[model samples]
Target: MMGLILLPQHVLHSVVHAAMGVLVFWCCTVLGRSQYQGLAIPCSPEPSPGATIPAMCVNERYLFLLLTGGFMGYTYSLRYFLHNMNCLSFPSVQQFKYLQFRQTVPKLLKLSCVQSLYLTRNFAAVYFFLGYIPRKWIQSVLNLQMDQHLPPLDTVRGLLDLSLFYQIWLSGVFLLTTWYIVWLLFQIYTTEVSRMDVMDGIRWCSYRGLLWTDLM
Candidate 1:
């Protein structure tokens, strides 16, 4: 009665978001500085090239913090989808398990599929910002320190750091690809296969790409 009123999907979504919020906050608090070490602005007065603001005055902490927050949040969404799939594939209970497989699992799987595709859309946005915003700012700062003396080509090269862009793109792609793979695995588990064997849990973990090293 109350369960129908409350809506399990809403509850699960809220719990996932709340849990990820804490995780992202902790990651930003602990690992932010190290992550942005390459772009750290030293305390020095320097006339930046074609720059209005001083080089030393620009703060980039907020940029890295935002990136970390977004990255962790979407990453958690993928993990949540995988967790739901694993739970759905677990060996059946003596009685209620069949009921859940018939009734609850489909609802949860549908919700998870939506969550995964929705979260995957954020990959481009996150990667774009990481490339065009934070990296751009770092380049501008570096150019400012150079005092516009460098050639146009060199300046352009400095500003458009392909390596950083590629790294961010790779990370985003990794998360998105993982979600798709897991989503497919869950789809197969639910539709193509009906029964969960004793080895199902282990097989599910393998499908999730949980390697021996990861378990260790």
Candidate 2:
């Protein structure tokens, strides 16, 4: 019999991760538009307050939301994957059950608690590493004041300041985003392969078990 009744794992992961990539792209595109980021704002010495760009774009909050929500789903998919993978790695009868990730890492799938922790961690990372430290380094090296408060995006200087902050933020978050996509791909690849295998196994077992016994 076929090892699994499924599509190619590579193709599956590509599609799944691509879907995630597209979503991130959409969010970024929306936030980075010329109107929003002050890209096309009329040249002025003063900061223009035409449309307030959400501070989340320039900090770790959005990153927090993006990763926490996305990873939660990724991990949940893993739960499903393991359930299927177990059937083949260690076959079991219908009456048997297996313990999962929770035993090793309690509340791993609890969304509320996990999200709260993620938010706190993201804030700390931004304050110490991703956002604050890098900006400070750049300001000290370039002799620029990165502490400008909500500079109007309509002016050249204001736009540059916002751009600088966001660039640093993006540079940091990009690494995590890349890894998250990779993680998604692996989960999809293994889970899908195991999905079909488990199904075929169940079908074969059912031949002489549930349906067979019932029909007989």
What would you estimate as the lDDT of candidate 2? Answer: 0.40
Query: Can you give the lDDT of residue 57 in candidate 2?
Result: 23
What does the lDDT read for residue 43 in candidate 2? Answer: 28
Of the candidates shown, which would achieve the greatest TM-score relative to the real structure?
A: 1
Which whole-number lDDT from 0 to 100 does residue 110 have in model 1? 59
Q: TM-scores of all models?
A: 0.31, 0.27
| Tens-digit lDDT track of model 1 for 67-177 | 544654545654655456435444434334345446655555555455534543464345444544654666576663322332221233533544434433434334334
Candidate 1 residues lying further than 4 Å off, grouped into runs, are 1-159, 194-216
Q: How far is candidate 1 from the true structure (C-alpha RMSD, Å)?
A: 16.4
TM-score of 2: 0.27
User: What do the candidate models score in CA lDDT, each in turn?
Assistant: 0.46, 0.40
Pairs of residues at least 3 apart in sequence or in different chains that clash in candidate 2: 47-152, 48-152
